[model samples]
Target: MKNLKPMLLEVNANPSMRIEHEKELSPGVFENVPSPVDEEVKVAVIRDTLRLVDPHKQKKKDRLDHDVSTAPEAGLPSLCLKQVFPKYAKQFNYLRLVDRVAALFIRFLGVKGTTKLGPTGFRTFIRNCKLSNSNFSMASVDILYIDITRRWNSVGIDHKESGMCWQAFVEAFFFLAQKKYKSLPLPEQVASLIDFCEYHLAVLDEKRLVCGRGIVERRNALVTCQTDGLQLTPAAHTPLLNRMATASKLADYRNHQY
Candidate 1:
């Protein structure tokens, strides 16, 4: 038995010889030896590999959440505006500044914060503002406008106090815009117009200038239209004589006829 054990040890030391002997003695024993992989480990490896290869799946196992109140307030960045439109920034009044910022923010809410504003888009924006935030006493238009104006002035875009009528305000803005952006790129011009339109509506609201009321009031004034003649008719028309003072030529015509 001792001699047999020594021979077996010698055979086991040579792995090739031992395997051949084992196969001949018990071929089925190796066949039933269980696989080394744990099922849970295999499943986890496959899941990880799949996440890397598949573009549709997100690699990050967790997502971040943001609260609305935590997000910064959206508005025209005066510093950016000053750089973008230097001339307008320097000359724009406080009221004009307020209009532009409020209009752009309010209008953005109308289109879910995308797309260009339309001609009558502000009318719709006013409706949306009332619905969403209403006259919440805390953040009323007056308070908001004041805040915006102060910020704009701080950025060196010095605000002038001009309670000018809405028409004059709009005319002055467009004039400066034309001069400033005439040679600039198309994108800058379009952006200015968009901002200007928003500002226009805001100034009107703040000033309480009604387009319809202004038109009606002007139409009712007799002196609103210019004239040059006695009855104050249009200057382009023939002059009006004070009276029909030219003597009749009847007597002279009668003598000539005889």
Candidate 2:
């Protein structure tokens, strides 16, 4: 595991608009990282294509016509682990979870000769996990709490969060300050969250620039709320998604869901 100390020290000492320097490595390659799995690992990679396709529908598979459209086009596949532990999938939305897990897997397990998961060795790891191909480009996704703790612990943080999203980062930042740094007060902890994201912009992966866009939007929204007399409390900070799912049940409210 890589220590974030050097990266942190460098950025803090000499902050600049110029981009930070990074190694020129190929995609999915990390230096000196080890495979996340071991003999003790109970989760196993599955390679059954039948799980994703209807074998009886051979005619459909043979068709080459792009004009033939279908409602609900074929969705991304699923990981064997989901099948083995159906209970886990029931608790969380697997579609989103798989993206983050796949990113971690690529970072740590892209070595040669590792057990393959699909068609090509890499594809096996991917399709078996049902990862979005776009995950290769994602800066970060909402990660599982366990994954966050595991990664943070590996890098020497005795205490950690479930994931490193803005919410988690904000809490951790204030936690370091003993919850007394109250220069900027709002509906909740909006300013503190933005502050953490601002600092993190320099340290996040270069490819994560896209992810930075969302953080910028959220930070601006918080600033606007502060300027306009809108409260920024934890309770008030509920995302539009929650509002859509709860308060807005009628068809007219659907447009606000975005």
Candidate 3:
């Protein structure tokens, strides 16, 4: 059995139905008898077969999609900034900016296979970017990076293997830009900083530019809050009802003939 290859013979779709067999009684008289033992055996076989097919069915909690509260760190499909940041989506061309930034990021880090960026590579990329007419100075950029790092650490983000996905990168960019220009509104500040970065990136050499490596041009699925707008019943109401029943002196009353 171990040396031979197993071949699939047939598949029974409805295997749990009870089967009846004809039992000959006297000369030609026949009676149909249902076999409960055969039915039970069939059910056991089906259950054991399913268990063998899916061995990880009991460990579903360890899967990636089990916890929807946290964001994915690595191996994420290409994402658009609009889906991740819908509030500022209509204000600026985040799609284009994300692509441009991703191209530059790939070139700087020489990234291959995956679009994830580590902390050290991200810091190097930020330092290399020359922002013109922007409020962010060298010192301010370092401070912003530190703040974002602390935020990632607080959320228990693992930067050792997969540093930051495309979504995280765009989120960090918006956070840093928003912090630097607090007086301006969200749309204005983000747009202004994007313009400055775009002008600088536009003049760089196009020979080493790599497109669609880590980031793509499409919007990924959004993660929505499952518990939003839920109204839970108050426990105080239950206590109030119990108190009313006790006040009426009906707590020990019993009707046996009803």
How does each model score on TM-score? 0.18, 0.15, 0.34
Relative to the true structure, how large is the alpha-carbon lDDT of every model? Answer: 0.41, 0.40, 0.57
Q: Give per-residue CA lDDT, model 2, range 1-258, as digits (tens).
A: 134232222224443322233443789754543334421122222223344343324357456563434523354333332232444565554334334334434443345444212123333322333332363312222232334434545665433322233333323334422333456554234344334433443344554776788899999999998876655465566686687767656655777675
Model 2 sits at a Cα RMSD from the real structure of 29.6
| Stretches of candidate 3 exceeding 4 Å from the true structure | 1-109, 132-143, 153-162, 179-183, 206-258
What is candidate 2's CA lDDT for residue 251?
58
Q: Which of candidates 2 and 3 is the stronger one according to TM-score?
A: 3
Error of 3 at 137 (Å): 5.7
Model 1 lDDT, full chain set: 0.41
What digit string (tens of lDDT, one per residue) describes model 3 on residues 1-258?
123544443378765355577789889999989777766555555544554455334356567566543444234322211123455556655555666556655765555666566656666666555641266565665665556656655576555544565555667768756775779987667666667665655655342354433233222212122223132345537788888888666534643323
lDDT, candidate 2, residue 2?
38
Which candidate gets the maximum TM-score versus the true structure?
3
